[model samples]
Target chain A: MTLVGLAARNVLRNKFRAALTVAGVAVAIITFLLLRTVLWAWTAAADYAAKDRVVTRHKVTFIMTLPLSYAQSVRSLPQVKASTFCNWFGGKDPKHDKEFFGSLACDTETGFTVYDDMVVPPDVLDQWKHDAQGAIVGDVIAKKMNWKVGDRVTLQTGIYPKEGDWEFRISGIYQAKSKAVDRSTFIFHWKYLNDNLPANRKDQIGWIVSRVHDPSQAAGVGVAIDKVFDEKEIQTLSQDERAFNASFLASISAVLTAINIISVVILVIMALVLGNTIAMGVRERTNEYGVLKALGFSNKHVVMFIVVEAIVIGVAGGLLGLAIGYPFIEGGLGRFLEENMGSFFPYFKIDPRMSVLAMFLAVALAAAASVIPAISAARLKTVDALKRIA
Target chain B: MDTATEKAPASHRDKAEALVSLRGIVKIYERGGEQLKILDGLDLEIAKGSYEALMGPSGSGKSTLLNLIAGLDRPTAGSIDIGGKRIDQLNESQLARWRADTIGFIFQSYNLMPVLTAVENVELPLLLTKVPSSERRQRAQTALRVVGLEDRMDHFPRQLSGGQEQRVAIARAIVNDPALIVADEPTGDLDRKSADDILGILEQLNRELGKTIVMVTHDPAAAERAKVIRRLDKGQLK
Candidate 1:
């Protein structure tokens, strides 16, 4: 028999203990995958932001607005390819109060060009631009609310408190080119908000999304745009779209940190469970180890035997967890996140990298769990070990 | 240094001359921080092919004496010379190497690795040597054949009966053709018929193969098969 075969057999000496250890590792891998997915989603906004796009908002807060005249000034720049403005509708469906999505009042003609990654068919784009009271919804948002073509939907905006309600016709449904982006946004014509506003609030814009000639020149153009508006009464904070997303993520950084801490706790629990099982097995087979040593096997061999046993347990557990975990996330968690938190997570399936990392961790943790047991086994003297009964 | 060791036995090629000599040996153990002397000064001479038995009571330090001769435990004080080399002066790792090369042991209870088959258990000792994998297997099969267990080479220790397991253990011990064979109560756990058969096998290993045998046992029937009988009481041999 091979040395590895002996180790594998010894690991199965206590069937229940080996099974428990595999279960522990599987649970840890699941927790680790869940936390990693949250971290990935949180950081995806930063990773997938448009490189040639710059956003200018009110210096004090995004809650305030800029003048429509600022768009005219920004469009005048030589490096500026296109410029569009959008105001947050802060609108919610009265029926599904908890279901959130991006509701924006944007320049229908220029908004589509500036945010080209938010791709829609030519017919839908033309239809959306031609109809003034038309609102185009994302396909994911359409599916969730079960809205159809030519459907009239009313949105209640708390920010722009209206006389009764604001109504718009569903003109088109848009999809995201990149999975990093949410496909659940509802974009309406900016003129609708402007027409409903009082004369004092008219012509006010929430934020400007400007596409630059080159991604490398985006920062310089952003600076120049902010400089042009610096002389005005309202100041601006101009940054690349990625930095804008990072700032939003920073607001919920604490929650991400908590998930990370809990994930490490799960690893510790896995280590403890695996370590305890190894220790017990080693203790029971102390005399057998002495017998091996008496037969001229070195301490290194003894340690290798134990470590090999742990690795087998770890690999088995990791595979079992992946077997269960893939469907659990994709079929169960994936469906829930896409339906409820579509604004934040348009696609919530497990990434290939996350699955690989989980498998690697299982093997590493299995070997790591045996470290103490191996050392203890090596430290035992032949006479003392032989003296140990059972 | 004693001339009497040469006259003991000169029977076979494995033991053409005297190899190991013990002058004085003692072993002491510390338990619960209290010193307990297990073996006092004892002297024994063993030649190359002598088959001798050491008979003793439970407290007679027979196992302790066997451990010292096998180079497994260090004597508190004394010189143990084996194969013209002083074993007591050697380090623990060096002693282990020496034992692996020159000494073989069969315990009262068969100590074969439970996971291994009879052939694999026999091959374990050859792993310490520089033998190739194929040669190790060949040598293990040859040793199993010598013990009349070639048919059971593929059987695990658990699958073997008491006597067959003992035979496998013997095969593992002699797989390297060790010059010295030490059996401590080798037949104590077996019934009379099996014990007699095991003794018969040991007799063949000694008379035919010329292997020097040092056995410690409480059974007079086992000791009667040996050429010489030595009795130990307390720590001294009489």
Candidate 2:
């Protein structure tokens, strides 16, 4: 038999312990992949942001608003291709109070043009443009609320206090063409919201969104637009779409840091589990190593036996983890998140590189874990090792 | 003075040339800051094709001397020449190679790899050599046949009796066709019947195949089978 074959057979000598160790490594691998996927999905929005779009909001906070005239001024810039503005509605359906989704009041004429990733049927778009109180709902929200075209939906808002609930007709159900777009948003006409607002709030807008002619010049265009309002009564913070998403992510940087630390901790736990198994195996086989040495095998050969055994366990555990992890993440949890939490994780599938990395880490950590045991086994005196009972 | 040029006694020269020669052998081990000398300065010689047995009480250094001759351990101060090669001067790796090519070992416990079959255990030593896989298997089968355990070649150690396991270990020792066979209490763990069977095999190997055998044993019955019996007490030959 080959030396590697001998090492592999030794791993199966204590079947129950080896199986338990493999299971431990597999569980660690699954936890690692799950945390990594969460981190990846959280940052996917910034990674997939549209380069040509820039957002202009209040310098101090997103809660404050800019004047409606600021939209026209942004559109008048030489570099701006199209401009639109939206205000957060904070609308809730009384029927599904616990269900959370995004609601926005947007400019009807320029909203679809600036946010081009949202696809609506031409007939529905026409209806939404013509009707004063018409709204376009995303397909995910439409399915959840069971709303059809021409359905009358009433929403209660915490931001704007009206005499009664606001009413609108569902003119369109939109679908997202990119992962950057939330698939569960409700968009209505900003004019409908502005006309009903009190005199002081009538001319206010939440944020202005503009598309640039050249994506590479988006930063320069943002600077020029902010210059327009630099000395005005209200200063604006302008950024490209990616930078806007990054700033939003920075608000919860602690959560991201925790996920990162937890992912590394899982890898450390995997190494420990592998190391314990290898050390135990080496201890039990001390006499066998002596026998090998007496049979003209060197210390290097003893080290090989222990290291190869650890690596075999590592490979087996890695394969088992991937087998369970892929379906669990992509098929089960991913579908649930995309349906329920699409605002945060629009696309929640596992990345292929993550799978490769998990396998690589498993094997690498297994080898690293075996180092001390392998060296100890190699340094043992042949006569002393032969005297061991096992 | 170089021990290689030292003249041998007339009686040893009258027999076949010496296969193993030791001069001024001393082994010391330091434990907990105290030096314990196991084998004091000693000298011995074993001729080729001779069957010799080493006998002593506990802590008499018989095993230590056997280990020194087998190249399994080094002497703190001594010269060991086995099969015309100065083994005491060899490094750990070179000694391992030398042991593989020149000496076969049979332990008291029948230290067969529990994971490997009898034939595989026999073939293990050949892995370190340049022998082809097919030839290695053929040679292992031949060695098992020589020990009259050819039928049990595919059985694992746990499946075999103690006597049969010892036979398998013997097969492993002879599979490489080394010049010297060093056995440490080969029959220590066997019953009287099984021990007799193992001793008979060793006798046949020496008489029929002309293989030199050096064994360490406590049983007087086991020692009587050898052509020459040497006794050691407190690190000195008696």
Candidate 3:
């Protein structure tokens, strides 16, 4: 038998204990992968953000609105190719109160132009532009609510109170071409919303999104836009889309940090489980190690046997984790999260590189964990070891 | 035993070259902050191809002496020359190589790997050498055949009787054709029939293969089969 073959056979000497250790390591790997996927999904918005786009909002809070006149000033900038303004409708269907989705009242003409990644047919765009109360719903929301193009729907809003429910015609359905964009939004005309409001609130818009000619200069253009309103009654905060997404993520940084810490803790737990198993095996096989020494195998050979056994266990556990994790995360939980929490997790999928990294960590940590046991086994006196009965 | 009739004369043994020579050997172990000497300044020699048995009571340093001769442990002080090589001067790794080339071992508990089959256990020592896989298997089979356990080559240690397991251990020891074969209590755990079987195998290995065999045992019946039986009491040969 080969030395490696001998080491591998030793792993099966106590099948039940080895199986339990392997299962424990598999669980740790799954937990680590799940936490890493959460972190990855959270940062995916920023990673896929459009570089050519800038968002301008209130300096103090996103809840506050900018003056409607600010949209014109943003559009007039030389670097800006197009611009649009939208207000958060915060509307919900009374029939499905528990279901959450994004609702926005946007400038019908410029909304479609600024959000070029939102794909709508020419006929549908024409129909939406002419109708004052026309709405464009995302395919995901359309499928969820079972709303058709010609169907009329009513929504109740908490932000903008009305005497009765607001009504709109579903003029079109839109799909997202980029992962950064949510596929579950209800977009309607800002004019329809403003015309019904009192004079004091009529000319207020929530935010402005502008597409710039040069992506590299988008941040500079955002600075110029904020500078225009710096001395006005209300100040504006402007940033490129990626920085804007990052700022939003910073508000929930604590949750992300917890996930990161949990991921590391899982790896530590995996190492402990692996190390304990190897140590136990070494203790139980003390007499066998002595016998090997008597057969002229050196201390280095003894160390190799223990370390290789641990590595095999680690790799086996890693494969088991991957087999269970890929289906559960990418296929099962990912679909549920994308459907239910599309605004927070626009794209929920496992990163292929992360899978490879998890496997690599499993083997590396297993080897690291085996170090103490290997040394202990190698340092045993041959005569003393042979005297013990295992 | 039939093989005892083939034992060489004392003059023939004296004329043969010495396979092992020890000069002023000493071993000390520290316990509770005090030095405990196991083997004193002892000197001995054994001719090549001799079958000898060492018998001693508990704590008589019989096992320690065997360990020293096999290069499994270093002496606190002295020189050991085995198979024309000065083993006392060799470092740990060099001594391992030397032992691999010159020494084979059998244990009372039949220290065959539980995970490996009989043939696989025998093939273990060959992994240290540059032997090809096919030739290693063939040599291991041949060794098992020499021990008359070729039919049990595929059996695991747990599947075999005590006598059969010890035979496999013997096969593993001789697979590399070392110059010296050292057995510690080779039949200490066996029934009388099994013990006699093991003793007969040792005698046949000495006579047919001409391998020098040094065995440490507590059983006088086991020692009686050896051509030369030496006794030790309190670290001195008697």
Candidate 4:
């Protein structure tokens, strides 16, 4: 008998239409969340990147490398506290030919030091540094490949095309401490790649990474590093880690932007679905509205009732979407994205804000959807409504 | 003879002093650039708790006049005073507020919200008032009990018979305890048995509860039950 109870009951007047409207809203919210998740994960790398770390890449192309001696000049900068380099190994496991993971050649000792967020066990780091032909893999990658700590694995180099299969002993496994770090990379000593390289590729580093003494001076250090090699035959583009991650993200900018737009479109569609359902219900209940008016209900009261009904339906749909979306994403999509695109998305979970916003949007859109119908229903002439056959 | 010609509820005459007075009320409807006059300077008055029937042919403006008295429609040009206050001058929102406080309405078709149970439908009018929901439900139940529908209070409209539905509608009308009750063809869609039952309920409400009943109906049997019957032709009472 309460207004809220009556409003809630009114949503079930046409069970099928109401159910369809709720389903439409649920689908919209789910799609919106999915797309928003994509957009969030795509930019997460840049957002979580370290401001104190600087990256040095070729000014013309990332494919080109800088002289290993460039590390000396980078370390000499007053702002640079620690400096190292990591060359993209571009190595693939011969057994699992299609599974994509990062392979990097890094300074055995200083590489992990500069990027200390990546955690490796003490024994593993010591063992990795001791062996020349040794590599450390991520725990996730090791579990997938089922490689033991001491297993000898051979990987084929796609870029270099080694004369024979490049073999390495699995010296250790590392784990990521944050979402920003990829959990499927294989990092080996730079000396291992450099010692076996041809003369043309010898003593060259893919990109120099530096940790700054102060985050405020990071931009200055980056400028100084680029300036040091700006006039040389090989120029450098030095930036903080965030900008370095952004360049790679720029490759899939179109997909990310499209997803953003589609997320908005789903919300718009949800609004439309809500509006249509409310309009239809109001039209069907015109006579009932007229009866209410005759019984002394103010126009405001009538409108409130209609809007409350719409909002009740909206809440139902929002709760339904939340109930379904969480399990669908975490159980189904999360595992798929984590296993397949670990580099881009370490975890595919819905943001708390997205769920909160969905609830807000549901209520807001429901009220908005009822605006026209409520107004028109409230405007019904009492006599005219009475005269209605129904 | 009384100054108002004694057209008042017989039992409540002292309190029934011409609650609704309409002088020269006219209503014109414009449809697609064509103007149609529904009411033409109709003048009438009814005292409180009067059980009066308005009988007329189609397009006779009986419903229009009732709508004006109930503050549900505006007069094209006239003065309408209900309960000693001029109501025709009120805006739509003001009229709505006034109607909620003073008027109860019943229709030929039981225009109950089908989604609501009979008690919920009865409780609807109290939403316009300041009554709390629990009190509203109690009042609605009392109203349904008065109409002998207490047992059916929890049933939806579809589950009730035509007469029961009409009784539920009447319960809803009186739930607000409004001074005036306006019924437009209250039993127009009912069968003989249902119509008789509805008519009996209205009679009881008028005689026992002293509710003001102003009904517009073409049914002679329904008109006969009214204490006073007014005939309308060409938008004028005759």
Q: Which candidate wins on DockQ? A: 3
Output the TM-score of candidate 1: 0.92
lDDT by residue (tens digit), candidate 4, B1-238: 2322234445656555797889988899999999889888888878776888988899888878888888888888989998888998888788878887888888777788888889988888787677886898899999999999979988989999888999998998888888889998989989999899899999999889888889999998888888778888888788
Q: Which portions of model 1 show Cα errors greater than 4 Å?
A: B1-16
User: Whole-model lDDT for model 1 versus the true structure?
Assistant: 0.84
Worst lDDT 10-window in candidate 4 chain A: A381-390
Query: Candidate 3 on B1-238: residue-level lDDT in tens?
Result: 1212235675787688999999988899899999989888878787899998988899999999999999998999999999889999998788878888889999888988999999999999999999999999999999999989889999998999999999999999899999999999999889999999999999999999899999999998999899888777777677
Ranking by TM-score: 3, 4, 2, 1
Q: List the pairs of residues colliding in candidate 4.
A: A296-B100
TM-score of each: 0.92, 0.95, 0.97, 0.95
Q: Which scores better on TM-score, 1 or 3?
A: 3
For every candidate, give the share of true A-B contacts it also has: 0.34, 0.70, 0.70, 0.91
Span of ten consecutive residues with least summed lDDT in model 2 chain A = A334-343
The list of candidate 4 runs beyond 4 A from truth reads A387-390, B1-16
Model 4 C-alpha lDDT per residue in residues A34-126, reported as the tens digit of each score = 788777777877877888999999999999989888988898988888988989988888899888888999998798988887898887788
The Cα RMSD in angstroms, rounded to one decimal, for candidate 1 relative to the true structure is 3.0
lDDT of 2 by residue, B26-114 (tens): 99989999998988999988889888888999899989999999999999998999989999999889988888898899999999999
Model-by-model lDDT, in order? Answer: 0.84, 0.91, 0.90, 0.84
